[model samples]
Target chain A: MNRLVLQAQILELTAIRYTPAGLPALDLVLKHESQVDEAGAHRKVALEIKAVAIGDVVRRVQALGLAGCSVFTGFLSAQKQGRGTVFHITGLES
Target chain B: MNRLVLQAQILELTAIRYTPAGLPALDLVLKHESQVDEAGAHRKVALEIKAVAIGDVVRRVQALGLAGCSVFTGFLSAQKQGRGTVFHITGLES
Candidate 1:
């Protein structure tokens, strides 16, 4: 039961690369901003997250080209060789 | 559409504190471990995320303590004075 549904804009994107298994992978940074209700008060929330898209979703994300906001469905995992987390994208909705 | 539902165990918990606004707040670290299907391959995923419970949910999380795994529903926000993100817990399911 690890799932994340986020609506954000692609703030930065890198060239598509291939994994060791030859799967296409795209890395990007996403910027999210919204107002949320917390402790009975409305709060403005904003953050940027690092995300990656692999396999079939890579092509779709490439086509989008950081044009507008999109809803992304994914799971979070630790960076393979780093100190932070990465959102592994599995689905996308423009 | 910013939501995250994760099942994880509480790795570390801080004593309940009060916010400047007088709302109760509890901070904790969550460790998540699972197997996920990605790019047509099964991958083992594990991550430790910092999370916080405020308002009414703080009491519930305090009662649960670090006993076992639980599902948490929340939103991600940037750390107020840091570079990373924090999970703001809103709901819990044991």
Candidate 2:
């Protein structure tokens, strides 16, 4: 079995490009459906985050918040175009 | 217990600002150390990819690769500044 890890639930999301002032703009949207942890019961959370890296993108993501998640890295043996890393998320509607 | 997913391995990295050619510049670097699968024997891969999102970033990440992995979304109740979503990953050199 592949070595897996623990990730939480994803919720509603929105993204915005970072501005000169510094705050990132929320310009993206996503459909969510995942599992999460509440006070006690194992309630499913709403949104999830997932990404890939080969250079510093991954590390940058982690530095942002390396908490509970199962990140992955892979390559397209086909095109070989997407070298470095390719990540995704689980949970969410799927 | 929080709901989690199956992430893969992360690898070495190198990023550069995208060019006119239209390749998102890979301008970053990261460490590797994780697990993977090959035919049968359970082998730990040597890389992991992780990231966070809010707005269009998360959707962008997933649109890239919506595979087997545990992604999460959360908020820093403290700041409320990092609202929208915050994701991270495991399987890396935590």
Candidate 3:
């Protein structure tokens, strides 16, 4: 099980691209800021993550503006062979 | 809301440290491998994330051997100085 639920602002959006299989892909950067409970204390948290959306979700989010705040549900995977992690957006709720 | 639920192996563990406020802290690396459904397709996902645990959770995880799999619940935050993200572990379920 690998799931991430984040409400973040759309910081930047890259132009849509296509995979070798011709699937539409979109990449964006997300900025998240929130207060979270941890170990019986509330902490202020902030993060910036690079995210990618594929196929229909790509078009859906592209049609919608990449502005303001939205909740993204996805799984995290490596960006390439064995390095950094990238959030793969599968669902978006504005 | 910033929540991440991941079932991953404890790949590496660092010595327990203390925060500025004297809170017990532990840092670890987690490797996750799983199949997730996205865009109507099943995709294999794998990620290696750096995580930190504080207070009692640090002691609890420190007491247990970090040799097997465990489910972690946490929120993502910048590692330091607004740079890369780090998982802040708050709970563990083995």
Candidate 4:
């Protein structure tokens, strides 16, 4: 199974604008400590994920009749060691 | 001279409980990448700092009559790139 991961803090879970095409969005305030972006920058950046991935994970969970609300607290991270980037997914928040 | 640095996101600057002793507290939601604490493990953790150091930074600013509200966005970091945690302070948020 393919998976994607992001490294950031769960700043706030406040609601975002309900887009004209999809459900409401979420505003995530995140930071970076040592990793550099495509711009070769060394700093923290805040990005927003308007639409949560409703792919494999979402589909599988929905099939099991499990609520997606629980995934809201999962912190994502993209870690780069000597070579290669690994997607690290944290365990579901209790 | 003494200095302290923290690495985390600005999460929410909402007003915190006004202790009968001080002004207000700022809640920070931060994360870690590869560094390990005293326990000797690899994982991420979130910590909070209340009652910001109103020391040299605050004292020096108060001398020039500059408002301290500006420093609210400064992100602190305790990075262990190779060894020895170095105190890194971000430039004032412009």
Off by over 4 Å in 2: A5-32, A35-80, A83-94, B1-30, B35-37, B42-44, B52-94
For model 4, state the Cα shift of residue B66 in Å: 20
Interface RMSD of each: 0.9, 12.4, 1.1, 15.4
Regions of model 1 farther than 4 Å from truth: none
Q: What's the CA error at residue A12 for candidate 1, in Å? A: 0.6
DockQ of 2: 0.08
**What's model 1's overall lDDT?**
0.90
Name the lDDT value of residue B93 in candidate 3.
Answer: 74
Which candidate tops DockQ?
1
Candidate 2: tens digits of C-alpha lDDT, residues A1-94: 2222323322222333453444333211122344543222243444433332222232333333423233232221111243223222211211
- Model 4, range A1-94, lDDT digits (tens) per residue? 1112333344333334443444333333323233422112354433322212222233332322312323322322322323112222222232
> Whose TM-score is higher: candidate 1's or candidate 2's?
1
lDDT of each: 0.90, 0.29, 0.86, 0.29
Sorted into a CAPRI-style docking class, model 4 comes out as incorrect
| lDDT per residue as tens, model 1, A56-84 | 99988888787457999999998888657
Give the per-residue lDDT digits (tens) of candidate 3, residues A1-94: 8999999888899998998778889889999988988777788998899999998898777876678578889999988854667999999876
Q: Give lDDT tens digits, candidate 4, residues B1-94.
A: 0122333333323334443445333322332233422112244533322223222233332332312223322322323233112222223332
Better of 3 and 4 by TM-score: 3
Q: What shift in Å separates residue B8 of candidate 2 from its native position after superposition?
A: 11
Which model is ahead, 3 or 4, in terms of DockQ?
Answer: 3
